[model samples]
Target chain A: MSRRAQENLVALVVLGVFIVAIVMAFDYGQRARMVPLPIALIGVVLTLWQLVWQNIRPADELNIDLLEVLTRREGEAVARNVSSNFDEQSAHQKRQAAGRESVACGMVLLLLGLVWVIGLLPGVFLFMLGYFLLSDHYSLPRALSYSLGLVVALYLLFVQGLGIALYHGWLEEWIRNL
Target chain B: MIDAIVAGLAALMTPQAMVFMFIGVIYGLVIGILPGLGGVVAMALLLPFTHGFEVAATLALLLGAHIATIWGSSVTGILFNVPGAAKSLTSCFDGYPMTKQGQATRALGASATGALLGGILGAIFLAVSIPLVRPIMLALGPSEYLMMALWGLTIIATFSEGSLMKGLIASVLGILIAFIGMDPVTATPRYTFDILYLMEGISFPVAMIGLFAVAEMMKLYVKGGSIVDRQMTEERSTVWQGVRDAFVHRWLIVRSSLLGVWIGVLPGVGATVGGLAAYAQAVQTSKTPERFGKGAVEGVIAPDATVGANEGGGLMPTLAFGIPGGEGMAILLVAFIGLGVVPGPDMLTKNLDLVFSMVWIIVIANIFVTIIGLGVAPYLARLPALHANLMVPAVLAVCFVGAYATRGQIEDVAMAVAFGILGYLMDKYHYSRANLVIGMVLAIMIERNLHLSLTLYGSDFLLERPVAAAMLAFIIVTTALPFVRRWWKRRKLAAAGGRA
Candidate 1:
């Protein structure tokens, strides 16, 4: 698939899954009912709109060029990118009319769920430190120092200064209270 | 007034209050200098610590810290072209340009003094607005608040810079995030999906830090960059010229301070709207309007004044009605409740002393902040130019600590990290993150207020209420005004072209 179709397909798949989850959440009493009612309706509408718009709408006529928009902020850069991409823009529009599968925001939610699994401190410390080192923000020595410093500061501020209990997650909570 | 001043000074002069005020001011400046975090995050983080302090002492810390951040944010925006907060984004327009022009010292000085003057005048407006607050609170109900929020959102049209649809999309996304927790009216979990931690909803500070701070950090990493520009032009001007410019733009100070106070008093508009509205007004009123984005001193002064004034204005509703104006004020409201001060009209009559004490804190904090802010102007202006190596680790550590401090939840830290990556992507992609952040901040208030209005008055909420009707009309006008101005300018340009 071309890039636009690819992007829209991703959005639609996510919205489609959300519609289902929202439908399921309709049973969470009156409160949960509020969410699914509007969310499902909106999700359905957005998905259908995405699907219909992409099928009928000619891409070249559209003002927004997503790739060009992403690559630059200035108007001239946009114009330059658009001009350079113009010849292939028509040819790239030809794409597979078959087999497509889409996923949900399940990955995002899974990330959150795993966050709870690891507990707050270790999970966050590792995530931030790992992201830093992996992303090449710092060398190993620097990343370790930064992460360790952040943990110490956080401990001092929250645990020592404020005296609040930290989130231990369900497993940690079970282990500690037991 | 003199007697009130003396009494206020006496009440504020304690060693503890003085020390706390100093600490809060310094802390606020540093926190503001850090990209992503703003005044609200600083206050929220400090709130959990102020639990045991006396009212005066607490105000010393909270009030001082809040005032000091206005300058702190502007300094970064001017020196680095990277705003410390969203409101300071406007400062980047002229500030960075001036920095490029080798007028960094003048620009830094101007922003600092503007903050000082703007803050003092804003405080004055706050005190003057006090007597009216009681009746104002009484006249306001949920319906009025809902209308007020609608009016607040109209500002997005004004702030969209150009594209209203993109801004609207950004705002809708914000509202979506705000709706993530339980329904305010039905107490329903709107989008929580049974996660227990989602019960209280995403802490506004956590989301804000994640959206801005974390995003900035991620962008720095992805781009392989430093936080500050770290370039030097010959420092050609004395700091006092900027100081004189502050006094020179005294009227703008008063005007923007009033704008800030007016927005602040409304009890939900907060500094984000206040700053943008003030900048918009400053640009509208400037004689040499073309100078605005190229380092107009008044442009710097206007937002600073509004930021100060906003604090005082925010205190009005927060103190009078026990209704917080913004996230920062909400924390302040909680502090008041913990101290056994029942807000509303009762605060005016019974706790008049305390009310005046807060007003005094505003004046004293601004004065202290100004002195400290001005003293450090020349040096702090150089932070953005720091080597990326040192800046990256220190800032990342501080930001993580900030995220963790909110709710004492590690998930918040992860959220910050994830959002940091998102923020960097958004910045790279040319989507206005400020609009997105504002949408997030205002979304909860909008959703809650809308839910309350819908629940209370049914879906025909505005149809029955006069204030709502009037506000709706006002929103129509304000929303159209920006577009009308833009269209008119376009037409005028076309007409000029045709004539040529």
Candidate 2:
């Protein structure tokens, strides 16, 4: 997708969220929805405006600031010197970046899943060790050492020092029951 | 007052109080460096240990930990993009960028020193303002508070970056998200989706951990580099440079500290709001406003100073009116009760010496934190220079674990991950996460206060309240000034071009 298309898609998603919120807000009491309803309506209007404005403008001009638009005359410089820090990349590089982002996202989900299934300590330990090993960032022994040291530190700080009851995971619960 | 001040210093001169203060500062710093834990947690954890200790020692431990956490949280926000707590979120805006430029030690030094100066100044202000607090507190109403929240929202323009529309939308979305919990006015759950956990609303710290910390790690994984470039790290600034930066920006520090103290004096207004407000004021007042959110040292200094001074401001209501300023102050109130220190008008006349002791603790503890912060800043600055592969997992683990640790809920971990994805997408697109956080911070305050203002004085509340009316006018002028200035500059340039 083009950058403009991606921006439009996100804007549309935001618009949809506001619309859904406004609809759901009506189900509440008058006092309950008083603040939320107006806020959501404002959100919808702002987002819809963003969607329309981004789509209508040329790709280069799409990065225009609203404040500048309000302040400047017609055909005046609308693009503020506000850098968004986005760099231009080739199609191949974009694809490569997208792939890396997907992997990163997947790793985050995998860690989350691991934590959910096997509790925080074991989950974090496994995730860290796997990441260290798979990324070729550390030797196996070093990875093991780092992971163990972190888990031990977590245990001492949270479990012992603070007296927090960490989640023992569904797998641990099942195994213990069996 | 002089006698009480001397008595306060003499009381804290005890070896037990000094030792406790040291231990509390260290513990607070450690907890503050952790992603989810903040001063409240540090103080709450030490509550049980407060028993049977001397009054000075007990207050030292509790208040010292609270003071230390302000700098502790800024350390992470500066070095990593991960804020230790919501109050430090503004620090991450410029502090992390400074880190990326390998100026992490400088950022840390400025943050610590800003806090130290703010703390001392706030302590002095607290002592001076004690006699004048009650009428000031009574003079402001819910309408004034609502205006203050609106004033906070007006600064969304500062963080809008390139797109005010997108920034407003992000802030609106954040406000909507804050409405997910049970409504304070009507007791009706607004957007809970019937989930039991949602009734309590989203945990601010958990969402913050996911938004900044987890999101940054994901970005690191994709970008394939350390947070600070190796080339940049070689030319890193010294800690003294940062300390000097804080002093050079002394006027900004004083202004931000006063703002912090004022916000602290207001009941239920938190350091989170104070920090963000300070940042907003910094941006608004700066001649080169464009340097903010991109490694302006003032951006780092303003918020840290505000947060540091906030502790002293927060104590006023807690000590004077038996009303806690914020959650940390609430916990301190609990400790005060245990220590047999009554908080009311009597507290002023009877326990004036005790109040002075707490003030002395704030000043002394801040000095200790700054000393320790400067000592370790060089080593802490090197953490970001580690390879992305090592940092990604290490930070993510801490973030997820910290998210769970926040409320001891597994669901908060899931919430953190979800927000992480949202944060990454928001950053990828041009949404202002800072605006969103500010929106979230002020939403409940605005909503609750608006309801109260409406109920108490009806719709014409602003007209009825002179202070609120003035604040509204101030908000309008400040919010419009930048656009007006820009337009005037552009017109002048256009005229110059025609002549040329």
Calculate each model's fnat, 2 decimals.
Answer: 0.10, 0.77
User: Per-prediction DockQ, in order?
Assistant: 0.13, 0.56
Off by over 4 Å in 1: A1-178, B13-17, B30-58, B69-114, B158-164, B225-252, B272-303, B321-354, B387-390, B455-459, B496-500
Per-residue lDDT tens digits for candidate 1, residues A60-103, read 42223332233222222212233224436555233211111001
Whole-model lDDT per candidate: 0.64, 0.88
Task: Please give each candidate's TM-score.
Answer: 0.74, 0.96
**lDDT tens digits, residue span A24-90, model 2:** 9989999899999999999988887888887787676666755447754222221332122223566
Best model number under DockQ = 2
Clashes of each: 10, 0
In the range B374-473, model 2's lDDT, one tens digit per residue, is 9999999999888998889888988888999889999999999999999998877768777788888999999999999999999999888899999999
TM-score of chain A of 2: 0.88
Report the number of the highest-lDDT candidate.
Answer: 2
